[model samples]
Target: MNPLLPIRHFVPDTEARVMPDGRLYLYGSYDISRETTYCSDILHVFSTDDLVHWTDHGAALRSQDIPWASEGHLLYAPDCIYQDGTYYLYFCMTGSYEGVAISDSPAGPFHHPVPITPADRDSIDPAVFIDTDGQAYYFWGQFHLRGSKLNPDMITLDVSTLNTCIIDEKNHGFHEGISIRKRNGIYYLLYTDISRGKATCISYAMSDSPLGPYKKGGVIIDNINCDPNTWNNHGCMAEYKGQWYVFYHRSSQNSKFNRRVCIEPIFFDERGYIAEVPMTSQGAEPPLSAGVPISAALACQMMHGLFISPAADNTTEILSHATNGSWAAYRYLSFDAPKSFSITAAAAINGGTVEIWADSLLLGSCLVTPTGGWDIYRTFRCPLTPVTGVKTLYLVFRGNDLKRRLMDVKEFCFYGDCGSGNAD
Candidate 1:
């Protein structure tokens, strides 16, 4: 079977959580303008009752509300931990150390304070995992990595027991974005090895304790084809309906749209080790029988053409037109009638025309307007006519002038029956 392709284009600085009420909530940075030095401090929230469709709940948290943050510093990776009756949001402020806020609800008007870890330590990408014994541990670090135990109340760290964690030496000590989970009395540490460029891989380590001397395990997922320059990193793992998944981000067409998130199915071997994860630059198939309906929200992993550089002056190659962004078509499906679908993108595109064709025949064209930054997620619905037995859909973008740019696509959702068969 073919791998799954990204249905939508762009979701930036991705963070995900499964709420106690049995719904999935995704929070991340939004309205990040490419031209601006700093993106918005707003945390946008989307919820899915079924993974296939999504409901936008708007901004869940904003930086202006956090008095500790600078006037325009970007709010990086945000994570949540549910303890007692409150949800704690651990996030990075101004790229220094990690700090946190608390709310009674998952969707929060969070209360922020000064940095949790000392500013001199240079920590970020905070992940909070509560052990079975009810002890809370905080994991954060990139180049200079560290982890420490937090008090049971989930506020401050237990300073006396700070533990320095191990990042793979094979990757030139480049490590950050640590995600931890305990299974069958074993602790697994998952993190990014970014030293190899597009060859960047997700590596793992194992330990007997939550705070541990973790021994390095080999790479779990390696070398995503879609992102030949960069691969998946900075994500979290969760179990839904008895299945496991890794949610992560890859570079968009370029740096401006570089951090869009995607997900793939994961499983543990009989020996209690994580099985090798499949890497796809595009996207992956939905998990089987997860009990949730496939909603538009589930399509978020689909890669729309983003980060394609602008074609050279007077260039006409089909690939050249994607100078600012590009996409690889996969697992194409056909339908007998017009199908309802949605499209979302990020960029400040002007005068660029998107042509959709099948079987070498022109279907139609739509004018794409740029969303002005990587953080604004836009969705559009339209009727797409499928060619009989067509196995591929072609998207062509033609820039009006040198000012033309492309955006990352987060996902596309089709409602109503087009045709039914195993697509990938």
Candidate 2:
């Protein structure tokens, strides 16, 4: 599966940090199904070593675990950092109050969440950055970018040193979702802005100091097309294994609340200007080869009436909700000749076919027969038209009843020699 595909349900507001043990750990707000609320009082942490496979470190911290947090408070965006063998988790609740938690491990059952922000200063999206000189800074805000020097305990902010208006949003395009990271001694402040359009776009600002009277950079990511109905964008940046990645979210299930995390590689120019990172289907991982099982959730684009959900076996099921024109596509496949492919699915509808297309040309298709139940599984095989080189693969579902589902497709794979000795 593509690393960008959410492990389960909507896990938005991603904050990625490469921990001391060299694994990339992800902490994000967990949404319940397709609810409009931010989160369901708990957060899960996921860690990946190779960027291809990830392990879910379930229930890192729950709102009930925090004593001072308001009752039934929704856990919003959170950030975790390792300092002195302890993990410090900075988080926000529905009331927009900031809190800090402590854990002995990176992926943790974090405990002891204490409110850090003052009662008068209500804000969300907390980001903490530690400088090279061993000084730690805390940031949180919406329209006005704010920060303060943290006490050595990392649980308390130096309220006397708080700068409530560090960067003016009117000049810098900072609306919300602040993330701080340093590269080459330049402090980069990445945040969500509505300067380009109504949709939240990830913009950046750079300065030489942690407390930045920073200069506005440019948009690192734009969420206008992330989803047809994308409402906002939230993300963070991290450099892993000599490569830089921008982590963001995309709305799914035809709702803005069901946003999923996504990532794409980014690069810096010689002048240290970070390039604009565009959203892609082939996230973080390298281009997929022919034999790798392409998860339906990783479909480059789904049009007509297609959707995805988690299925058994850790796979994503592509739901063909009626409409013969409905199609899902996987980008960039290498083929040598007329190769055979197989689809794993279960269809309750009879005589439906998954028409395959290489690039724009129609290939063959796999017949989907009635399996009694949608959960009943079957493997359908078919051959494609002779093709060579690289091209995008499109699977269009054909059936009657424009309002009914066709089948539940788990995955598809090409097994024959389709060129290329190795694929990443």
Candidate 3:
């Protein structure tokens, strides 16, 4: 589903790199907050040979290990690059101070970190790109974008070569979290665009050179309704197996924290313009087969205070705090004459009804009875007026009390004439 990793893994502000090992590695800051805050001290790297399945390389690095960084929890955003058999992890911490860590392996417990900029220098969200002619460029800044050439050591920048205002809020709608890429000699810069008065859009800019006189492009993706608090989106662009993808994230828990990673396929037109992509439940893979159980936590549109929380099992998650008017929609599901709809739900009271809609078509509605407790789960089934073809799925909850919770939804699936398994 769209949240590329597990429900509890809050990985955001990511940069994707395809290493020589033939696996695409994800480098990003870890968020462990339930409150309104940003990053934690740890770094987690995930890899996937195939886009659908991912492998966690565990904790690759931590801010406390960096002897020079005084503010550990502010490990904002990171990017990795490979040069001459070594991998460099470019990271930024509090006060906008940038640093670099090294490891022989692409997925690393990267150690021996050193500051790239002086304590007084203002910088954040380090994006490193190497040009074709053997020159490397370092980019970072907030509101205003900055770029410079990195020294051969790769830890410090070439001071004399620093360039400022490569792109800015007034000109390019720049906010922060910049990722750089190039295609057919055209350099593209992806950053948090300030277009919607918030950093919810991933906008782009293009130039002829690595550090540029760039032109602003429109949005690639926007995370506007993913949660009650959709504030920012920061990700990078990558081409793998002749396909281009944008790695981004969506917020959960009805809070600014607990954001989960997501991906969507994107492409360029004849003039190389990238049209804005709508966020979907079927992310970097094909439509989820209706025969298999789909987690309720992978919802693409969570609205009206409907968010997901960890289930009592401590591993899986379930739809939480849902009541009347709190609904969620899943994008683009393949249905083949599905006969019945089933859900795993729980409630401490009389419960509620789940109105199932296939886009605008009302497939059916299931009356839910209380399971006596929110932690007690029971599967309920309702006969559906079967609908076919690929369509967006909507689950709208209706209950007597708007202020009280109706049910906690864990997982759900559709049954065809041939029958898929029960929702368990």
Candidate 4:
């Protein structure tokens, strides 16, 4: 589903690359579940041959390993590139200081990290792109986009080639998180656009030169409804199997600190302008099957106090602190003759009702009776109204107490004709 990693792992600001091993690698900053601000000290990488199945290569880098970095566990965002025989991991720490580390593998316990020079104190989010002629370019900064050629060492910047103010931040909606790629002789610059009064959108621009006066293309996706307090989106576009996809993240646990990686396929027009994509519960995965249980954590859109919180097990998540009129939506579920709707919930409040609607079709409604505590759960099912097509499912909750948490919800499934995994 949408949150690409486990509920326990909050990895954000992802940079994706299709490495030599024929697998796509994702490198990002890790967020400790309890933190209220941003990222933690450690970084994690995930790789996948198929977009649906991912392998977490844990702890690629740690703050403890970097002597120059501060002790406050504030590693923010990272990017990794494979050059020659070594994988270069680029990271930014609390003081906006940027550095590079090396490992033999794409997913690595990267070692011997060193901070870079020619990087301004306000630098963050280092992106590396190699051109068709085998020359590598490095990009970093906050509001102002900066670029330069990487030295043969792959760590040092070619100072003579430094280019600054490549994009007008205030005019082009540039906030941060610049990732670059080239296709068909056109350079694509993807960044977190400063629209919606915040950096919640991943937008792009196009240019003929590597560093230039680029033209703003359009937004790729927005991280709206990922969290009530969700503020930013940072990721990059990657091509796999001749298909293009945008990798981004969403916040969880009702807080902006606990963010998770998510992705969706993107389309390009004849002119190569990317069409805007909305957030989806299905993500890059297939339409959700009506047969098996779908985790409540897969919800891409949440409203009010409702959120996906980490469970006691730390592996699963619960739909928590749902107030009256609070709701969450799971996108694009394939329902083939669904007979009954089922829910697993634990309620402390007495008079709460869950009105299940399949994109306004009104499947059914069921009472969420108290199950003693938030940790406790029980399954409840109601007959569906013969739902049979792919639709977005909405769990519109109602209760007398407008601000009180009604129940904690978990996995839910439908009883019907269906198969396993993706649709056939």
Candidate 5:
């Protein structure tokens, strides 16, 4: 079976919530008008039984009625939670502050927006978590992190326990895209740290109480197979068939416009802490699945590369590229028939190209282009020529102007055969 065949496309800026009935509902922002690109509105009610296919229920919310937002400003990064027979949708308007809408049904003609918290403070990406003790807490912030207690109704803040600083330290504040999950009596607060760039690192804080003096932990997820300068944040975690996974987005090859969702496995340590997730590009061994066709999101996670860029001094670092930028490879297996290979790239240089060679025979090259937005995803394919002996595939990024940055590759796939080879 083709590896890429199983991946399904999802609308951008979408967050998912699973109903008690086992149906998955998605809420997100939609780019309705092409003129400004930012003229996006909130789209509600998309559902899927299996992750591979999705059904759209049309716009559940739109910009036509929002009085506080300007015409061109779009709604973004919506999150939802169900409580007391009501689904509360929390979303950011104009990328400034978060508001909420209430609906009786999962797919809703939601009520008009109501401010959960005042807009005087900078806030976005509000995630509401109901802890084991049945207390609701709100977490949000872009550059500065903040959290607070929510009323039992989950619509407005309690105010009695007003805003609390979970991790408000300067240079350490990354309060966007937050999710709180409790496993085995330990509460894990998962959030994205964007100080590193468009590349988001997933870190967690653990505590005995939902609203806490939580202790911060190491990074659980970091960029793999994409540029650190590219955006890859805002995701949700889910468990399917007993495996824990995270669904998140990454900026396409161009590093700006196209953002695609990918999935990766989440592992836990013996002490219940998450293990250090290896960067993509250091190709991982195929997920154990009895060889069934897995979703492209999962496959992409398994084969993502590491983000390598010019250091602060603008000096290029020549490290062997690994799958997800962590695992070194001496051999690779193909996913398609005819033994093919491909490399896709986006960069800011002229006359720059990436060359792929196997056993001294040229396999393929992808030319860099500027017209392609800094966030374009491009794929170049090359058919592998049959050879009787050993084969070694090598990749090199070459550019005429050293000052011009090279390309950031998400990851490449080899198909058809596992030729005998070894890395020297």
Candidate 6:
């Protein structure tokens, strides 16, 4: 599997929540790959137990499905929370007006989306927090931060209780994308702050109540150059199985509009301050076990012409557009003892080799054999040079003719002498 590949593209403005069932669910703005738009007009939900494999729950809501929403307006940041045996999804539409939808399930084809925030308010990026006392609060804004205590219905906010300046842009750097979460009795307000650098950084403020009195808590992550055109960052934090994580997005394909979601493990010190987290290819979990079935879609990195995309039957395969130096990389797999690797792939033409490497060391190569058709699948194997312990894996697709497409890789696994601490 591409162990660290983004769950699906193009997911931006991520809000991660751990459902009562223990699975992590993702809510974000979706965009078509290589599209010019910042986000699409629909939302798709994805869930996972381990970060490696994700199941798409299909479209949760669509702008066209909302009677008040314009057909092609951008579907910006969204959020979801569970309370009273019901799940509520909040999102911002084209005009920056917010709305709410209700569903019995977390992964929903949510229904009855009625406008919440007034049309006059400049609202986007809605964040919902349910407090320990059963009180729910809704937060949203762009240039300025505004919030209010939500009514029992979880959709409407009391106009009298609204604070249109919970944390202003000038004071707390709250440009947009606000997320609220509580830990150890501390109310944390996370958002995009422009005070740091060229692109927005993930900064936070702390409060004693759901609607603060917030004090600047400093930055939790700085702006990054994940892609040369990277512009802004937006995300949320959730604790899963006693581990805390930061969910964020980065622009890719050299376009600021084409963003992909990424995550990293985060920590709060004994003093209750969060340390900054750096972007990494290793991802949020421990090294995956060797010799286990790994989806080719888990590639942590892919060079040009190499894409993990769906095939004719709607299953994913490595689209190897045989350009010179096209490659895919999966990082940090644990191997306790020596082993050989095998790959399952399909190719209509022969002459390219799947070059395997462990870190900087070349393990071996498997020659691509003609399989009668591009969709015809077959297994190929090659002996390794006995690499031990944990190491990054690189699969380079090199062909005798650089201009033609290589082969589609379905999956890969390792096998050989038994060794402790190797792939489970």
Cα-based lDDT for every prediction: 0.55, 0.76, 0.85, 0.85, 0.54, 0.77
Per-prediction tally of clashes: 37, 0, 0, 0, 33, 7
**Candidate 2: stretches off by over 4 Å:** 1-6, 34-36, 119-121, 159-161, 166-173, 196-200, 222-229, 310-316, 322-327, 340-383, 396-409, 415-424
Judging by lDDT, tell me the better candidate of 1 and 4: 4
**Candidate topping lDDT:** 3
Please give the lDDT score for candidate 5.
0.54
- The sequence of per-residue lDDT tens digits that candidate 4 reaches over residues 48-143 is 988878898888988889887767757778888888899999888888878888999999999999987777355888898989888999999889
lDDT of 3: 0.85
Per-residue lDDT, model 3, residue 56, is: 88
Worst 10 residues of 5 by lDDT: 1-10
Residues 1-424 of candidate 3 have per-residue lDDT tens digits of: 6888866678999999999999999999898847577888788999998887888899888878877657544687899999999999989877676788899999898988888874224878999999898788899988898888988887778878777889999888899989999998899999999888878899999999887889998999999889888788899999998899998988877777778789999989988889899899999888777777888877888777888777788788788888898899888789998889888888789699999999899999988788888878788888999888888899999999988889989888899322133332
- Tens digits of per-residue lDDT, candidate 1, 1-424, equal 1111122224444556788888887765453423323235666666665454666666666777667656766677777878988888887756464678887878776775456755223766677788998889887776645777897767778877787644544533346667787777888777776655643566677889877777766566653544333444666666666667766665433343344555667777876777776543224342221121122222112233333332222121012123333334433344444445444444455435555555476655555566565445455445566445533554555565643445444444344322122121
Model 5 alpha-carbon drift over 4 Å, by segment:
1-14, 30-39, 119-122, 169-175, 195-199, 224-229, 278-424
Tens digit of per-residue lDDT, candidate 6, span 168-257:
778887888899999999999989988866545888899889888999888887535455466788988889878888787766555678
Clashes of 1: 37
The better candidate by lDDT, 2 or 4, is 4
Error of 5 at 36 (Å): 8.0
CA lDDT for candidate 4:
0.85
State, as a TM-score between 0 and 1, how close model 2 is to the true structure: 0.81
lDDT of 2 by residue, 248-363 (tens): 88766556677788888888898778888655567776556766666556675667656655555543445434356678767667676757777767667653778989888988
Error of 4 at 340 (Å): 1.7
